[model samples]
Target: MHATTPPPSTWWSRNWKWCVPVLAALLLALFAAFVFGILMLVFGAMKSSEPYRHAMKQAQTDPAVTAALGAPIQAGWLVQGNFSSNGPDGEANLSIPLDGPKADGTLFVVAKKHAGEWRYETLAVNVDGGERIVLEDDAAMPLP
Candidate 1:
């Protein structure tokens, strides 16, 4: 008696179980990368804005801030706030984290743009477990 040979298994029948999970994992990784990239872009834009830069500069240079938090102050990456602009008209309210050798703090800023200029309404740094240091800018100084 001759015996019949079984047909070879198809590719999908052989590999589908492992392939499905791998494909799913790849898609999830790609989606996560996309979200992280978008967040970085938004935060980078905020960091480059006039209000953020101005506040950081003040915090770094101010004598009161340096004395409280120590020298060589640095800004943190996760800044929280809203910044919107339309030509020379805009508003910015931001809270930027700061760190130094002695302590940590949060820099708060509230500013408005008018006639291509940034006018700060509130700019101060609250040191952790310490007093808040208010930054004062000269009216005569130019705003970039």
Candidate 2:
């Protein structure tokens, strides 16, 4: 009588232990990357908006802000706010962090867009351990 040959083991039965964890790790990494991409997109949009640009400009140029925070002021990355627009009308309420050679601060802006023009309701900077400096449209000192 001839001896019977054993059936070959399936690929799944041989590789599943390693494959499962590897696949799970890959999926986790992909999901994390997707979330990070979304956050960057949102932050980039806000940073590029007109209100953000205007507020930053005002903060950087104001004499009081410079005196408190020093020159070469820079905006921080993690800005918190709500911004919405439809055609010629929109609203923006933003809290932006700032840093410079002398100190750190937060810039707050409340604005609305009408007739395609942004009108700021409130624009101010609160220097760390110092007083708040309100920026007015007519109050910006001419840059030297």
Deviating ranges (above 4 Å) for candidate 2: 1-5, 139-144
Which clashing pairs does model 2 show? none
Instruction: Give me the runs in candidate 1 sitting further than 4 Å from their true place.
Output: 140-144
**lDDT, candidate 2, residue 129?**
95
Over 9-116, each residue of candidate 2 has an lDDT whose tens digit, in order, gives: 999999999999999999999999999999999999899999999999999999999999999899998999999889999999999999989999999999999988
For candidate 1, write residues 41-106 as lDDT tens digits: 999999999999989998999999999999999998899999999998999999999989999999
Q: How many clashes in each structure?
A: 0, 0
Best candidate, lDDT:
1
Lowest lDDT block of 10, candidate 2: 135-144
Alpha-carbon lDDT of model 1: 0.94
